[model samples]
Target: MAGHSKWANIQHRKGRQDEKRQRVWTRVSREIMVAARTGGGDPGANPRLRLAIEKAKAANMPLTNVNHAIAKATGTLEGMSYEEVRYEGYGIGGAAIIVDCMTDNKVRTVAEVRHAFLKHGGNMGTEGSVAFQFKHCGQLIFAPGTSEDRVMEVALEAGAEDVITDDDGAIEVLTAFADFESVKKALEAAGLTAEVANVTMRADNSIELTGDDAERMQKLLDVLEDLDDTQDLFHNAAL
Candidate 1:
């Protein structure tokens, strides 16, 4: 997971201002809509919606937009009916890759995803082909200057499984999926905010790549991420 950590660190250094904030807002809004539609619009009564709203607020997404999404999800207004899809594949250096998406058209989404892999020296694979190489876990990342010991104390008390310090001084708390919300709330109540908090697939093992292979891997991942339908991209490449 070194590569994943490295990539995450790089993204943090770049900061949210470096990316197109509007694009990020759109993605977060879509997430909110989907979570609300599936779990109901009331965050107080819906854990999934609550988490989605938390993420949206963290991104500084407009409250009006967030409320409108919930309304649409609750059928107070019309909205796109998105379906969740997962695609597994192998990238350069035999790195395992997984792409999560929310789309209204599976056929189009699959075709575009497969083309992305093939065009980038990767190949899409059958379901479970590379999925078994990963595990879904709750990940929470804290900014620098946050006390690791203090964060760990609260996280562990809240049922976090592990707290790791990355090379960039960022703290990452891993927890069982069931304990994610509890742990996050604990941290928030203590005035510790996570830069990134989500349930994500972590690779069980990683492959190392350098030189041209590493560059190619980065480009491929970027292309995959740029896809509007793509939600999250996970890979086993050790950066």
Candidate 2:
């Protein structure tokens, strides 16, 4: 594709996780807890919780652990409370970066995030500084060789916003954040399985980095991702 589809990003990110051996379960657990606490514990009734459960399954998280996280969040068992936070910043080459976090301590999270940015040739920005460059949306990507016509038919019929076939033949389906779950279910019912599906911050444009700039920007992203409270990260850097 354009090397920027949801599928490509997932593959690249998974490759990085393989090399780093990061504890993805920790982040997934926080997501489940937050989703359950904010919406009811019932995945069938809560789109956010359903998405969290899907992510946990995709990660191969233990069923018991997932259940326990839900129980804790729903007050069936005790669990640490977390709040969602977003940090915007500028990276090397002036790339826009957005860090998503789930933390119990806002002060600690902010300091840790700020330190990572400063240490890696980046600087944190005020809230909303870089946020306007992104649009919150649900994305689904099918691999090359998928039936573009079928995807478009099903996606459009299910209330999707648009269907795009990238240069690499990957099919990308976009939908409003609110319709994500329903659209996903409809796609599955139509026997269409996406290689990657999730709600994400989509950048309107990207800043291509090369050579030393690319290296430095990657280092900054890695440092930010390694932070304990970090949940999800998005950036406008096209490596």
What are the TM-scores, per candidate, against the unseen true structure? Answer: 0.90, 0.92
Clashing pairs in 1: 3-239
After aligning candidate 1 to the native by TM-score, how far in Å is the CA of 49 from where it should be? 1.0
Most accurate candidate by TM-score:
2
In lDDT terms, how accurate is model 2? 0.89
- lDDT of each prediction vs. the true structure? 0.84, 0.89
lDDT of 1: 0.84
lDDT of 2 by residue, 132-158 (tens): 999999999888899999999999999
Clashing pairs counted in every model: 1, 1
State the RMSD for candidate 1: 2.4
RMSD of each: 2.4, 2.1
